[model samples]
Target: MPATIRDVAKAAGVTIGTVSRALNNYSDVNCHTRERILRVAQELGYRPNQMARSLSSKHSKNIALVLSGFLEDTMLNDFETMLMKGIYQFAFEHGIDIAMYVINSRTQKEKSYEQLCYEHNIAGAILFGLKTNDPYCEALAASHRPCVTIDTEVRGPCISNVTLDDVTAFDELTQYLIDRGHRKIVLVHGRKNAMVSMERLVGAYQAFTRNGLTLTHDSIIYTNFLREEAVAGVGAYFRTHTPDSATAFLCMSDMLAIGTIEALKSLGYRVPDDYSVVGYDGLEVANYTDPKITTVDQNIKEKGYEAAHLLYDMLNGIRPAQKLVLPHTLVERESVKNLNELSN
Candidate 1:
């Protein structure tokens, strides 16, 4: 027979109410006592029936993780894989199950979100790819349901969010290039509607202005973060402008950088020797490039881990912060070269 709460209480030498409080992570429970109860429960292999617990506590025992679009995009797919791995690992340990939802413009308008929530009986949600002006965000807030956004912003009511300091990171990266004596820099940005893309573009411009440099409209190009798009965009930009026009390229993602690098090689442009490149997202593939990409490491796996843990806390009645910002670092690699030395 499966171990019961009463059995755990007896094993821990605590009252049933005390066991309940400890299991629920109530603040009133003594830390030591709670630890003891947890230890005892583990020793006896006590697995709480999530369904029964939900029925008793008026919770749905289901949480939703919503992505921005379909899994066709390589960058998004990679992020989803890493994020889901972390989320599932944490959820498994905590006896929670995740219901994943992929929301696009079509689904958002087709009653899919509501149908998903109802079908899964989700008590809370974790949303990714929230646009700045997303109307669904407002509806989720108005519903008074606990939700968290990953790599996006959620405002008003009981919503929480986690994102990187994208602007600061981009600024620091661009400044690093400038400090290394790169005067002519090109930017390959992602979708315009993405908050991250807008912030990064703003940071790039700000970095140039702060250093008494000017950015022409032709200095920046936009792509949909697709490999083919990256290749075509960079190739087209270079075809129109001379190699001396820009000494370096700052890509919004490593995948884009890979595409740009391939395009450059096809045009007889040697990386770092003729042009330097930097990318964001320190994916494993970044290192595999001919000259390993210099990038901003956002620790994607950790982001997912933190998101899952935050949701778990919210489910247990712990009110976490409204906004969580993860830290990022610059990974210097061979792809970025000092233009001053090359010029000499």
Candidate 2:
């Protein structure tokens, strides 16, 4: 038989009410006392009755992690996987229950965000992969249910948007290229529907404008956030433009940058010698690549942790800032070559 809350209270030498508050994660509980109670509860094998807790408290302590339009065949990449790890760890530590759902276009037509939340008794949600024009995004923007999105901006009564500082990171990265004497830079961007891609494009453009450089529309290449797409896009670009035409390629993702490098190698061109390259979302795989990749590290795990905490705050009636832009850093690797070094 499982130990009861009374047993946990006795073991911790605290009142039943104190044990209850601590178990429920009440902010007012003393930190030391809460820790003690949790430790005692774990030792005593005390599990809170979810139904009873829900009945006593008006709000459900459940959160849903929704991944929108995730393809079944596609492998779960590092970003989403790391984000999920953070959210799962946070939820486990805070005693908040979490559920996951993958919604496709068909599901979007059949169920609304509110309905899903209601059906699952979810207090809030951490959402991902939503495009600006998605039907679910429209509903999420209109709904008052507390929702936190990664890299996508949505504003509502209880919505919180969390992501890395894309604009600043990209701007700094582009400026780095310009400082390295890269005059002709190619921008390999993600799909147009992704807001993050658009923000990155804006930042890259700003860097060029501030540096007194002109970028034509032809300098931009679009990809569907796929390595294969990047290979095709870069390959097509080289077919028309000379292999050495551009001094550098700034890709929106590490995969794209790796793909660009692979494409260049296939054409008998070398990286940082024939053309420098930089990538975003500094994934671990980038480090394993030959020459490695220079990229903006977005701290994917931290994004997930913060997103969960933000939703927890909202659930507790604390209105966090409308948008939280996490810090990003430029991870310098061997992919980019300084022309100044060549001159020297």
Candidate 3:
């Protein structure tokens, strides 16, 4: 038989109410006492009654991790791996259970978000891969449930979001190329629906505008963050424009950069030596590449960690709906060659 709360309370020499308060993370409970109660409860195998807790104080200790449209065939990349690690780290430390709720446009049409959350026993959600321009985001904004999105921008009464400042980071990154005297640049961008991609495009535009350069329609290649798409897009772009028509490729993702490098190699060209290249998302693989990638280190893991924190804060009313932008750094490496005539 499972130990009751009363049994654990007795073992810890605390009142039943005190045990309850500690378990619920009430501010009034002493930290030491709370730790003792938790230890005692664990020792006795005390499991809180979920149904009863939900009825009395609303949904308790359960969150839904929302994922949509991630690549199913490939292994998880370093950015994704670290992001989830950070989120689970917080959940484990807080004793909160996580349930994955993967949905897409079709699923939303079949069942409403509220119904889905109810069926999953979800108290709150950390959402990923949502689009700002999609209709579902409008519904999410109106739902007023605690939802935190990663990289997607959806504003609502109860929505909190966490992402890096894409505009500034990408602006600085694009400018990095121009400063090195790269006038002929090709922008390898992402899908039109994603707001991050749109914002990053804005950053690129700003850099081009300030430098009296232009991102012509013909020079932009669109991909869906797929390496294969990057390869095809780059290949197709070069077919229309001569190999020397562009001196550099600025990619929106490291995966795309890796693919771009592969595409270049297939064409008898070398990175930096022939056409300079750079990428975003400072993945570990970026460093291990033959010549390390010049990319934006956007602190991807911290984005997930803070997404968890924002949702937790909203759930507990510690803070209202918040938007947190973590810091980003431009890591320049061997993937780019200085074309500014500073060559020895």
What is the C-alpha local distance difference test score of candidate 1? Answer: 0.79
What TM-score does candidate 3 get on C-alpha atoms? 0.81
Could you estimate the TM-score for every candidate?
Answer: 0.79, 0.80, 0.81
Q: Pick the candidate with the highest TM-score.
A: 3
lDDT of 3 by residue, 1-344 (tens): 77898998999999999998777667788866875786687568566787345443334446888877655415466777778888988888887767776677666555556545544556689988776655468768877578898989788888888999999999999999999989999999977888889999999999999999999999998998878888999899878888779999999989889989999988889998999999999998999997799999998877888888889888998989978889999998999888988654
Per-residue lDDT for 249 in model 2? 94
Segments in model 1 whose C-alpha atoms lie over 4 Å from true places: 1-59, 72-76
Separately for all candidates shown, the number of backbone clashes (residues 3 or more apart, or on different chains) is 0, 0, 0
Instruction: Note the Cα lDDT for every prediction shown.
Output: 0.79, 0.83, 0.83
- Candidate order by lDDT, decreasing, is 2, 3, 1
Q: Pull out the clashing pairs in model 2.
A: none
Error of 3 at 230 (Å): 0.5
Report how far residue 267 has shifted in candidate 2, in Å: 1.4
Model 3 lowest lDDT segment of ten: 51-60
Model 2: lDDT of residue 145: 74
- lDDT, candidate 2, 11-78, per-residue tens: 89999999887766566788678767766765574657873454434344577999976773155567
**What lDDT does candidate 2 reach at residue 336?**
95
